[model samples]
Target: MFTFEIFREEVITCYKEKKQQHKLYSQLENPSPGNLRNLCLIIFSNGLSKEDTQTFNEFFNPLNQSNELETSINRFDLDKLRPLRNFILGKAKNPKDEVVKLLAILVDFQPRPYENWKKSNSTTVIENDNVESGEKDSSEIEAEIPVNTEQAITALNDANSLKSNSKSKYLVVTLGLVLLLGVFLFIKYGTLQKQCMYWNNDRYIAVDCKEKIPGSEVIALDEHKLNNFRRITRPDTLSNKDVSRVWYSKVNNSVEFFTEPGHHPLYDKPLKAVTAYILNQHALEIKN
Candidate 1:
């Protein structure tokens, strides 16, 4: 867990100072071309256009009414981070406007290890250094399972000969049944997928959530198996590809919402609900 309170203070403090500096630069209604040139350099170096300087500066100025800088900064707010991101960015707020959010949930959100850590009856295989020491990690075991195939050319040839003469009526019947079961399952899975994505676009961060984020914070989730988390379990957002997002429950045990590209954290719900959900679901706890 991060010192969220400390990070919040750092963000507020930095913003206050930067806001003061921005006030000074902003006080000038018309800056000289040389100053503008420097500003232009800043923009170009940061991949912004010279023509958009006014808009960019204003956006970063907090006091600016409207600009691109504003839109970009809006995306980097803490409320937009995943539980894992909350553990990585720490308390420092970068001055840059283009802070691309990456999906690194393992950097934050540490969970308690499972109680029974040594109950494995199966041994993980080792590629090298195979010795009397039988201890191995999960990676070794996963690798070993993929290489234990038995060669079946002769058996396959015999089976082919047997099938060439025998009517194989039983095989045809079994295959037909399997085909029917597959279709039925496909229909059921389609229904579940829709339910998983039911709440994707409904909960606006402004209403359904209460994320009072101050600045960049990183929440580590080293042991949390994010990949194992199923997409909404019911029917999900109908995405064509796999997606990841930091999500918190909407109505306690009810469904959760995800952020696009990466995860965003939500707050301000009752503590009991958040606590129960984390302990029971969310994978906030580490599993390593």
Candidate 2:
């Protein structure tokens, strides 16, 4: 597995080190699926140096084309990445360490079964050639020297026992590590979920629930409100007529309207533009 969460953490750490404002920062802060895809595109499109760009283009031909780059980034195409990894390893200096890390993850996502197969095939071929040339096989030589069949059987059984024990130990260790990782992730996610903000004067700002302010009202964190923070993107098709003075929550059986553009404040949903249909259908309700 690529371990996207680890990769994301690395990217954020690197971004913090740079301490510069960029599209990558925004994507990191709110890593929705679309934002993550855009983050990859932004890194490739703008983050690479001149030499790195040339090298990338050389390995992934015609990646200068927007569509080609988009497809490669979207898929994390390993077929196109393995060569790039080899090239980077052979390079004298690699300025883009993040890109190198990404390539490493993508290229090493799966074990190369073919390498093992090739080694096995070569050994078999060499053994066949020796037999054809009338060379005594190791088995044949050992057969003449083996005087104690019982001892040989006992040794073979012991070897198999050791191998079985080793496999059992490995499996146990692997399962233990997986369980630890799961517990860590669960704790981390729970902490993030608990991180909520209270609506201050005009805008919401995160604060310690334990601290008390003298004059101003100090409200506790509301997970629902924090989770519902909306990032509205205006559609290109939207017109003046479709736009309204107030925002509207998404229609269910009944439409609820808001005075401003944000979340529903109570529901786990975002507020969107009040369409003409909502205006007409809820006209009687709005007057009251």
Best by TM-score: 2
TM-score of each: 0.15, 0.26
Q: Give a tens-digit lDDT track for model 1, residues 1-288.
A: 233343334333443454343322221123333332332332333353342444345333446544555344433333433331322234334422211111100111111111111111112233223532322332343334433244345445444554443346557868999999999999856444222111122332111122223452223221111222222433233231212212345555554533211233344342121234443444423221
lDDT of 2 by residue, 1-288 (tens): 234444434433454443342212333344344444444454463356454444345434444555464455556544444333333334323334345444432222222222333465577788768645533333344354445888777656655665566568679989999999999998756555434355443345666665555554445554323433332332332333333544667646766554344465445476665767666666433444
Global fold similarity of model 2 (TM-score): 0.26
Worst 10 residues of 2 by lDDT: 105-114
Off by over 4 Å in 2: 1-196, 200-207, 212-224, 231-273, 277-288
Runs of candidate 1 exceeding 4 Å displacement? 1-165, 169-261, 267-288
lDDT of each: 0.32, 0.48
Give candidate 1's error at residue 6 in angstroms. 54
Q: How many backbone clashes does every candidate have?
A: 33, 0
Positional deviation of residue 46's Cα in model 2 after best superposition, in angstroms: 27
> What TM-score does structure 1 among the candidates reach?
0.15
Q: After superposition, how far is residue 256 of candidate 2 from its true place, in Å?
A: 14
